[model samples]
Target chain A: MRCRAAVAALWMLTVPALGQHQHHHMAPPVSDSLQWRMPPMDMSMPMMPGLEDALPPTQPLLPSMTTPPQARPGEVIPLADGDTLHLTAGPVTRTINGQSLTMYGYNGQYPGPMLEVQQGSTVIVQFHNHLEEPTTVHWHGLRLDSRFDGIAGISQAPVAQGEAFTYELYFPDDGLYWYHPHLREDMQQDLGLYGNIRVHPGGEPEAAPVHLEQLLILDDVLLDKHGLIPWGEEVPTHALMGRFGNVMLTNGVTDFAIDVRPGTAVRFFITNVANARSFNVTFGNLPVKVIASDISRFERQAFAESVPIAPAERYIVDVLFPETGTVAITNSIQAIDHFRGEFYPHVDTLAFVHVQGAEAVPDHRAAFGQARENATVTNDIDAYRSHFDRPPDKELELSVRVQQLPLAIMLSMEIDTLYVPPVEWNDAMPMMNWLSTGAQVTWVLRELSSGLENMDIQWSFTQGDVVKVRLFNNPRSFHPMHHPVHFHGQRFLVLEIDGVRSSNLVWKDTATVPVGSTVDFLVDMSNPGSWMAHCHISEHLQSGMMLGFTVEAQNQPR
Target chain B: MITLLPFLLGGLMMPPTPGVCVWTPEYYQIALLPTRRVPEARQAEGAAHVSFVESPFGIAVTRAGHYRYKLELRVSGLREIEGHSYVAWLATPDLKDYQRLGPMPANNVLSTEVYWNKFIVFITLETAAAPEDASWQGPVVMRGMSRSGLMHTMAGHGPYQQEPCTVYGYY
Candidate 1:
């Protein structure tokens, strides 16, 4: 009887299962997804979990309560300072790469709508939730009023089905921001419920205006043969690694091509809205100058070959086409196969540029070629330069804990070892990755001092305090992966990564911390109100990897 | 407006007052060496030479292979070649065992850090966009040494700065 108890205890605890995996370095099967084998379906849970009906379902399209609606682009509602706009959350179907899939959209549009507002203006947004579940529109990367910041419990209650709530969004920074549901983003956001907000410089004449500009929302979806892959009914699927889609999308379509005049300098404002993937991409090897980021432009303009963007982060790059031809905008990265211990280059063309015409209007190649130095951003970060060496104010560990996972996952992960690479490139173990749902996995943002995980960690700061927080992603955890840590209602600077301080300091709301890495960010607690910080990966956010903190006046209660 | 900086190839900002440059744990200036590939007319144009700061990131660990300082490299006056790039490398003074810092990004700047006290910094022009091998298979175009590794780049500040940190022209 005692021996039986010991075996059962060992089965439940993953720490004891740390045995040696056979392959030290895995060489993946080349050129074929068919060669990759699947797992046994009789494990424990089905694609659709806890459904009352015991009827065996068809091959791919599982049971779903939401139906697909006719899809379209959310009408852009350009508002002046203090203007109001109406927004709605609903279900819609988007066809990607010739395949139609069901998704939860805003205002019947896949990427809701592009809300254009003037910088330094406060706009009132009346948000109505039409989805069956609760939702909230988080004005991501914005330092708006705390009441309108949009995390359900902190800013306001979750707007339930058929309910409406109002948000007074203030755009203080002149850059590209975004809006998306703050509740169950793993499903709501992954399906669609998102949009972009472009805040133009408030009434200021352009320093260096461009002939043309474009906003590109980069996204992806997981699809199968029958229809859209089913989402977990009880908890979020792909809980361990987050959902990596087979289909990639740009501005809600696979075929995202735009026309430009030869020798034209077009400014491209790119935002990554994917659930987990970090795209290391380039624009047809064009003469690309990185101009701005999430909140502010760089102090100095730079030319680079690729743009590596993490989820929820924004980058503004201007590309110059010296001659006319077809230019393919693509995301290419050397992805590692954890199971195989080999690297594979994954390249997907995000969009295309048909530059095959004479300059219709006067192009800005000459003006764009001129060097740009934004002294404002450079001078702004100088104040924090004195505090870089200060001891960290807080240390948070980004890690995952698991319970009730099947024996196969436990054993496989044990062999895979506790130490994994800094990044997970693909859905290497699809069946096991998805099966480790929220019921069995819990990603945490634990405060090291108090040993508090997630919301239990309460941090308070003065309105003007530059709080330095060190985030260490534990490499020893099972299924270790990258986490894009994002803070709400404030702008922070990435001070350092793995102990090296930042040389080029730009204001950012989100930053990616690779596995086995240590990152320290100094949050400019200028906004006084309740705020939250969490990993921006949609599935990780839904898996309880979040915490809420309050920012009071410098003289407020200690 | 976008234009080339006033030619100051040999040194930036009056040579940072040799041996008297600002040296706090927070911010520091790097003494960049002139590269032969860059013509005398280009100045500090073709390679990285600029700010090094200890931003809000924490103190460097004392353990081996732990970084204690960072350098933000800004390169200008260069053009891009298809599938080719300027790869950054940090190596020991003996020219053995290098850490291949990946290719410079679209911004023409390499955001980098150093865990070693004495090392050689070189930027090689590689045929590929990103090279995965440990050994660089390209020709070195620009080079600088961190003999005054951490703070001695100020020319005469610490024990590291017994040697001159800056050499104006390649000749």
Candidate 2:
């Protein structure tokens, strides 16, 4: 215990220093000049630069002066024909890199369709199951009636092949949400039964100076020589890792290009729909002002050097193209080349910003002032900090590890039909099972009973006792799992990572836990109810890498 | 280019081992039998059908006809991606087919077993004849699908294709 304490103290000393070094290296220098002048001409615009010379310099596809259509409340817009969405689900022929192949799609599109609605409005969607087998649609992250959540057997009956189901969903809050299948999620979601849903707040006039608002749904797919790979055909063993695709796509298109005029302030609502992969996205070297998150608008605007979005997460970033010739929104995280276990050199160009037409307004400096002030302040860090700092009665240490076995031995075990290997990794093993399950390998969450039948634990705490939890990722094992740890109903203050504390930690519901690293956070369990804590990776939770604790009033439910 | 080497090589380095028949009934037969019971020596004789196909990836076993059954081409010594690594029910109109179920509820059988970066393929049929028991009819086959510009690199090498097979039962 003394040695452990000593080690902890040493970590406390070293981590902060390392964090200081990283902060210095990563954080951009703040320009003290509050003049808000247009960036120098030669400074190279951040989002899309020098795209004017790349194109044939042709006339812009859409007029630059065109304004985006505004949406208002009490609008009963018909999203689909009745409650049933007549969607065509089948293989579509498409050519990628000069090779023609068939890929599965819904409504003849890779990403089904975009469903737009107003907050507090009722959404009645009639869906037709066109696939050969039965399936259902789940509105991810939407707080709706349990029956409309679309879980086969759990919430509602599965829409049989050639059958249809109508879902009546009421959007309680205004924000970004998504939809996909809840059953055979690994297969169906990967097979392209996914779409984006945006709910605009009711009774509010649209913010002015918002030239264009674009929905960017980021998805990663593993394509075969034919086109998009089909799911459910091959049954893999590893369920923890979920599925990883080779191709990264935005709005269902690869090598996509978006044309815009210089000095245009655009709203880019980015959503990560990948099954397992997390994206670190950058719009070339441009500055981005993040306005909102998954569920609601931020108290203040935050700047992102590079936005890291995990699955089922959303970030709305406002970026003004300084002098966009052409800028590339690229995936900054390097891909993992399977063979060498090393990083791969691939720059997936997600989108292109093509600036066309002569300068709309000379001296783009005026554009900043002309832009309406955001009702919310830009740099109110305290408001962001207040969202966290909740206290919890109980604290737990969660770890993720993988178990490795020889290929021949593992195959023999399955053929012999001897013993069923444990789904999750616990105290015994460390490697995750990506190959067998076609999901990431085994990950176990310990500090609980084995059977999990009677998981009733009482966590006692006062009204203001700051609950601190130290999360550790064992480095002594192979295939350290990156858990996007999340807490339900409330947010917390991220105190430290790898023992180093960060005062600049942003408020988030999900925080990525790197391999062989440790993160600490403080939470106030003021919300008296049973809350769940687990990795955001859906596969991990499906494979039993999850746990929950209940917070009660001092003399409440025993 | 420099970082992609390991991933490319990882795909290439995976060893291709052929499948082996771990359990084959001695006297299994695919024909209509006089009685359900059979002599010990010919345990598999009255069985509707029995056939196995071997490939570099693994072996596939299938039994069809009045009673339908399908077994995946699986490798034993391997572990599953998540949960227990065993033969699961892929797709069954009825939920109560498999003896023991996994984390997911019994009714939905989209996938049976998960293997090394690949999932096992199996399906059973539900008919009035075997209302309680899941059975299948006709020919049982296993196949692989690929898409264009998509590479299936194993152990860090090329997107190699696996040979598909159709298993038959001789009465």
- The prediction achieving the highest TM-score against the true structure is 1
Q: Model 1 chain A — which ten-residue stretch has the worst lDDT?
A: A51-60
Per-residue accuracy of model 1 over A1-558 as CA lDDT, tens digit each: 999978866753432212212111122335422122122222211122221122111121222435567799666779998788888887777777676666777778867789888888889888888787888889999888888888888889999989999998888889999988888787788888788998888654324677678888988777654445556656777788887787788888888888878777778888999988777657776656778788887767766666767899898888887777898888766554433323456678888988876774676777878767778888888898888999989988777888877655675565443224445645655656756677778998888788899988888887889998988776556666779889998888887766556666778899887665677888889888899999998889888899988988666431
Chain B TM, every candidate: 0.57, 0.16
CAPRI level of candidate 1: incorrect
- Please provide, for model 2 over A398-417, each residue's C-alpha lDDT reduced to its tens digit, 9 standing for 90 to 100: 44333344443243222211
Model 2 spans with C-alpha error above 4 angstroms: A1-104, A203-208, A227-241, A334-346, A361-391, A394-404, A407-434, A438-440, A447-478, A485-511, A516-542, A546-558, B1-171
- Backbone clashes for every candidate come to 11, 124
Stretches of candidate 1 exceeding 4 Å from the true structure: A1-68, A203-207, A360-363, A417-419, A554-558, B1-171
lDDT by residue (B12-88, candidate 2, tens digit) is 22122222211122111112211212121122111122222211001111110011122222211221223222222
Cα-based lDDT at residue A478, candidate 2:
35
Give the DockQ-based CAPRI class for model 2: incorrect
